[model samples]
Target: MSGLPDRTDVLVIGGGVIGTSAACRLAEAGVGTVLLESGALGSGTSGTTAGVVRTYFPGNPLISSLAVRSLAAYQEFAERTGTDLGLERIGLLVLFTDEQQVQDFRDTRAAQQAAGVDVELVTAAEAARINPLVDERTVLAAAWAPEAYACDPPAIVRGYAAAARQAGAVLRTETPVTGIDPDGLVHTPAGSIRADTVVCAAGPWAGTVAAMAGVHLPVTTYPVEMLLADAAGSAPRDALPMTMHPSSLRIRSWGDRILVGMGRPGPDETRDAWLQRVSHHLGTTFPALAGQGLEHGWSGNLDVSPDGMAFIGRDPSRPFVYAAGFSGQGICQAPAAGEIVHDLVLGKESWIDTAGLSTARCPGVPAGTA
Candidate 1:
């Protein structure tokens, strides 16, 4: 398209993975969809994600259910859309360092099992057998889910965008949304677009986008640093599951390199500082990778809610306005979120219950209508 159309059936804000997924679903449903992005596609948090797809949210049933559904979606993405996502089934190992943590894991495993998730509570030895790179002293027990996967994030985003474009979704990058009215008028520097419905899938900048529509969303963005380093020495090439530490640090194998990540509060962190911290943490936790030199490090923003659960569903006052606050887990649940947002826009009943994720359920958001 030469310029933004004067009007569209649905205007999707943001071109990250979530926005692209939503746009694809809407377009496939035969809606006139226009996706606007401030920067390049997947340049935000979606690009910087660890790309660990797992259904392991213990206490949050909504997230767990969505994750389970998304796992299936990702596994079938290439088959359904004929787009290669570079999906690798490396599995996920949630480590527990003590007896109490192990018991907690066991309880969570029970809940996950009842929800039809295939997870196994393994001993320290079993965990080591699954991934020998970890320090055995730190693992008392672990929850091993074999279906968890890791994928090429940028490729996945491109796949969604390509599919959306093929399905007749207009994608406009470098077009920032300056303003939005409750009645579906979207303002950009180029021109104004009048949409019948608007959906905001902005990742870390969701709060700012919500304010444009006069709705106050409680979304916080934090800086998260991650590093990529080559295997120290004689590291096994395969059969290593994506590992998570009790400290919330995650490490996964990326071919011959290791991907390490940790979330830090506030906005002040240098790349050098993050490298030092991550190197120390990985060395301390794994021991085998101690003193390994990090090859590269980068930082990205993570959108989070107060309760750590996603805020999804229609706005109370403006029913046509919908937002999805994925809170850093957007990739695994993008398809489900897009479908739910689509359903809400069309006033149809969603297969998945979304009452628990409504904006009204969030703090400081009033229940005007849902």
Candidate 2:
């Protein structure tokens, strides 16, 4: 529908992966749902994600369990949503250069194992055997999770949107939410929607949206960049997994090309300087692909929290729930996020323990709240 409905059971703001996933699950459960997006579905940060789905969180059992659950959801995405996400179970290898990181990873691996993740800490030689692209001289050891996977982020968002529509949810694109009331009223340019429950999944704009409802969300935004280079048959790229280099560069296969992602640059760093740093890291880590087909580079923002973890629960005062501060892991964790939102909306007990993910964990939010 081009126009907004006067009322809904649930009004979801943001058409990214998390919002769409929540709408899908809610509508599937027979709730009257309406989703409004400021732009086309997945046009936001969700489309720009590296789309790596791995169940490996360093010593965080809550996040690790959520990752494992979401990985299973992605593996069964096509069967459930009737859309193939082109999931590539290429696996993931996190390389550590020094002994300190190795020891830290030992603890992380133990946490992951305890959380039921099939991951192992392997030697540098074994890492090279798994993927010859590894620079064994620099990498001391690696954590390998052969079940990790990657997929099309935009496709995943569209899949959930489509499933939500099929299940009787109303989704409107190019509809920007301008105001939100604590009593579950959402205002846009077209009209207003009064809902029993509202969801704030607006990615980086989540804090701004929550503030409109008189809620305090401590989510911050940071810029991230990624470059795509032609693999050029170097180092058997087909056998390569989503590899995390010791220099903090994330390397993965994007079809025949290689995707290299660098974290947020320094506050005063110039674009050229950031590119130079990426070039240096790529060349030093993988010598063969130093200057090969450096085709495309792009930037996006991440919704980060002070704790670097997501807040997924209802607000303590407002009638809206939220799933924000995903940092950069929203794509991999959307499925679990959707389930949590669904449970909150219906007042049902969530299977996953959400005490650590509540908004109360944010500074000044207080305990037993969001």
Candidate 3:
């Protein structure tokens, strides 16, 4: 009783943003919580994220609402913990390429407005004023969300971990979970942790971890790559907005550097070929970033579900097991997802409607749904 206990009320697997945030909330509520991470906190996908936080997700009310709540949580986290989240609310602009896409933007703007998101439809010229990177020659229109922010993912993860520790949660790094049982036994190289409940926030490895517990989760992993470059003459004078292009490429300002990201391409494409493609894309869209020499690059696996939305909630059959499938929005949804996990473990009413987000709602990996 004087030292770390062998048993805890909750055993959280994974030390990423989702796990640490849940641990923070659970410990703040006086639960005996233990969080185990195979590697350092935020060193996985959380570390490689683009770190864009916004409440506009086209037509999804659940994600938008959760994101709105999490933005407030992020601000509170920075204020209370004295942690600089590097939260630059420089806004987000998604450019449309054609009239049909512009109409889609109109519908999306309506949906976002219905969900209480502060979004507006801007002309191509106005979009250029916001980021000065839009290709006015081909742009049809744009959807702007001024409340969005770009943050430091590592700082956010560490902030949650620090708060969890201060609230009495025990966090152990390099303690890889070897196996898990339905009876609440977690096996690790360090030792066994007997828990009353287990929260799986393992990201890409969630499916593997679930199998050890005799459960199957329909989660898949894909490699997503990003590029970084110095903002000497390639970036705007002021902070640039997170710009999403129709080509699925996203570019933003990360301090004095430009961050570029896109979904993974085919295996035949080499890194040099990909960079050339990215350069061409930038030349066509921004023009300012054309031929800009990239200083760094990295890649990480994105844990995605069949429906593209996250699968959050406890398993109906295994009441003690909870899984949070972030689907690449972990940083934006982690704060609220953590609270939802806490509510599930404590048998309390969640702040938002989580009925539709259950894993049971997932259709289980359809043919080729990304």
Candidate 4:
């Protein structure tokens, strides 16, 4: 925290989607930028994401609104950059078994509609018609957002990292930040880098990284677990629409495989175990999935901000900026976060409000946890 061996206009911690987007935007703006990642690119939650980019979040107005913007940014950028990110506008089908939960979904869909998201509520009969596989008894109602989408997270992640690098941001792989200083000191295993501004986008490890800077962040990072099936011979032609279950579970198909995940899976189970549990649970819930076999299972830790949104903004007392604790939806919201950080760095007006997500709004430093 003492030495200033290297210098840059901005220093970004964490090379995940959020950090990569920030670096790309910052560098494109001509802000000398340096990005650091503890591991390989897109190896975190971003990698594990089924690439679902939907606007049917429970009732999160801020998140849903920003998701709309982020999704647009992704689509536009992918086209302009000529990156085959495998983005698909497959829509989303959020299922509800409980009547109250169904009502909640209806209300939330209405809210999303009001927020400019093309979301609609459908009856159980209509839902069954949409996806005959959906157990009619288990569904009370459903919401469909046709504009929602999914993509290959690896492509998106690599696209952004590559763009950031091509745009002039110096990127370091497997570069872990050992320490940070409010005034702009970043220590890594390889060397040190100094900057006038430091942005902490350390995904699930945001708390620990913030700690090195004498700051505490309120983020409970947990493992992102999912079950991936190769479809063996019954591979569905990606008709799944990033469906969600009453248990906050989500299922989608990637290539010839299917990936089942959770929007909120207790925050305790590892991906390895969650896959087994979810696969078994799916077997019980839907008899059709009785013999469904899981092929490859993977897990990654995703930082969850207490408020279920990303922690983005400048530290009130310290001269540092941060963007992490995205719960488990960072991949979809990465662009919005980057735009905000880019504007903040450039002294431009914010395109959206991010007050509630301020690291100062909540407390509980990501206390030295693994």
Give the alpha-carbon lDDT of every model: 0.80, 0.84, 0.82, 0.76
Question: lDDT of model 1 at residue 91?
Answer: 88
Q: Give the lowest summed-lDDT range of ten residues in model 1.
A: 361-370
Shift in Å, residue 302, candidate 1: 1.4
C-alpha RMSD between model 4 and the true structure: 3.7
Tens-digit lDDT track of model 3 for 55-116:
88766767888888889899998998899998888898988888988887676666677667
- Candidate 3, after superposition: displacement of residue 75 in Å? 1.1
By lDDT, is 1 or 2 better?
A: 2
What are the per-residue Cα lDDT tens digits for candidate 2 across 260-363? 88885678988778778888888777776777645556778889988988999887665778898999989878999999999999989999777789877666
- Give each prediction's root-mean-square deviation over alpha carbons: 2.3, 1.9, 3.1, 3.7
Better of 1 and 3 by lDDT: 3
Clash pairs, candidate 2, are: 359-370
Per-residue accuracy of model 1 over 116-218 as CA lDDT, tens digit each: 6788888888888888877777778888888777877888889989999999999999999999876778999888999988788888888888888876677
Give Cα distance to truth, residue 2, candidate 1, Å: 1.1
lDDT of 4 by residue, 1-370 (tens): 3333489999888888899989988998888988888889877767766677776676786788878888889989988999987777777887877878777766666667776788778888877666555666777788877877767788887899889889888888887898876567788888888789888888888878877877777778676556666553433454767777777666666666667675435558665576567776666445456577765567677788767877887766656788888877887789989999998776687977667667656565432221
Query: Which residue segments of model 1 deviate by more than 4 Å?
Result: 265-277, 367-370
lDDT of 4: 0.76
Indicate whether candidate 2 or candidate 3 has the larger lDDT: 2
Winner of 1 and 2 under TM-score: 2
